[model samples]
Target: MSIYIFDGTMTGLLSCIFRAFQFKEFDVQVSTDANVQTGLFAEVIDVASNDEHAQRVWQGLKLKASDSAFKQFYYAFLSEQQQAFQHCFNFAIYVFQQQRDVSKNYGHADVLGMSQWAKQVGREKHRMEAFVRFKKCQDGLFISLVSPDFNVLPIIERHFKARYQDQRWLIYDEKRNFGIYYDLHKVHQVQMDAGAIDRQTASGHSQSFCIELDDEEVLYDQLWKDYFRSVNIEARRNMKLHVQYVPRRYWRYMNEKTL
Candidate 1:
């Protein structure tokens, strides 16, 4: 058995996949940041990130799996589940051989786990698309923060870019510690702790905005609260149904409606 340690980036995982092909060994384990103790009986290999290798893996996936399946695979990778890594590896190899839709195939335990995790992560991604609320900054950049259950920072870029074509904005996932920055011209990944952009100045932009609440914004918020209180029917309140539809974790980010 051989153990391979990767840098834990998407590219690093792709590089490990390439090395796996070269080694041709069974009983392999993929890990990140964990050191392997040297022993006379085992071999340890370190894989380096290679864009070419990542692109090759991507190309093969594009051919063997549908676009949706590939997206599920990506989400499974971002799930941060240790066991999920091997499951992804096994699923990739299976797709290469089966050449059919194996997403629903629950014949294997690992496949079933990956399918469940993928579905969960994908659902969160869609919910974020619908529920994201951005706060406009002084520089006209819209910003919002979320701590998602999965690494959904990568999945939100396209939706915001297409929907807000003429705006500069950022939607940060505090859970994953990363964000997507869309500067109107293009969208790119950005490190969260790099710098600070004031969340209050409305400088050069003139479109309807959604911004973070501050002391000055209390009036608008109170108006919303008043509207919510006035419209609610106390007799129709169903706590169970409301909690079932919107989990408690998301309540902090919601406006007056769900509070």
Candidate 2:
């Protein structure tokens, strides 16, 4: 038995996949920076991230597997579950060895596992599109914050870009402490320290944030609340159904939820 430790990047996982196939390491388990497990009879191997090697593996998969299968593998990786790395690896093994479409092969545990995770990731991706509420900044930037279960910003950005192409926007993941910014032309990823941001926006700071919604923004907020209040039918109100769909975890980012 063998264990592979990777840097937790997709490239590192792909590089580990390359080594797994090259060395015929069938009885193998993969671990990322976040999850490393031990086995009594396992030999540990540290895998380096190699972009070229990873790209080769990806290109091979492009030829051998369905487009949806790659998404499943990617979504499984984003799952960040303890066994997700190994699940992705086993799915790859089936694809490489079988050289046929095995996406519906529920008889294989790994295939089923990847599909389940992919479904979860896809659900979150769609939910993000529905739940995201952006605040307009003083400098004309639209800022939204979220802490999704999976890394869904990658998938959700496409929708925002397509819908609001003329606007500058930033989607920040408070948990991840990184954001995706979209200018008129392209999207860029940015990183920030939570402590630094807190200090910068502290009471003594020159400018305020979060609380800095100007008068116009405050009016917009009121307008939204008033609209919802006018349309809300007390007789039809269902708190259970509302919470079931929107979820309490995401309520902080919603505008009308504040009302």
Candidate 3:
């Protein structure tokens, strides 16, 4: 089997698809930087990122798959999981031959895995929408930090940008090590330095201050915690349900316990 290595971008994936078509005569294994290593007796091919090649693959996908299927594939592509990439690539090829209806074949392991990953990624996206709390900085910028299990930073940008149009903001994902910085004019990806990030206040933009909870802020936070604690009626409190709704990993960031 021939092994194809891609650059790990949407365009790079498309280029790989193009190359795969050219080498259809052989069985191919696709991989990226995170998990690519040449095995004994395997031939490795690197897929070049080309706009035209990407466009061609995109056009083919649009024709073969429904809009919903295309979106599912796109999000699955961004899952950053090695298995997800393989499943998505295989699923895309399956769609090319059998069309979007191939999803009905749930018996396939790859199809089931893709669906599970998409559901997980989708839920994280929704939670970020519901739970993100932005604090206004000294410069009138609203900022927040998140460390979502999945790379949902890119997905959160559009929602925050539209909801808080007039404000400048930065939302950093500590897990992914990148952030979205909105400077009123445009939103861009930002890399944080360890030194700068260590000095960040609750506002997330301050370079030389600790996040001090003032009396009012502390009171508000306590009120929120009280409300959260009070709302859980002991009779109806199901640990399983609570864990399902909000995972424990995210509890560390909840205002009541997040401090």
Identify the leading candidate in terms of TM-score.
Answer: 2
After best superposition, candidate 3 residue 2: deviation in angstroms? 1.0
Give TM-scores for every candidate, taking all chains together and pairing residue i with residue i: 0.79, 0.91, 0.80
Best by lDDT: 2
Clashes of each: 2, 0, 0
Give Cα distance to truth, residue 155, candidate 3, Å.
2.0
Compared with the true structure, all predictions reach lDDT values of 0.71, 0.80, 0.72
**Model 2: worst 10 consecutive residues (lDDT sum):** 199-208
For residue 109, model 2's alpha carbon misses the true position, in angstroms, by 1.0
Give the alpha carbon lDDT tens digit for every residue of 58-154 in model 2.
8987877788877888888887775887888888888889856876687899988888888998999999898888777778887776779988888
Show pairs that collide, candidate 3.
none
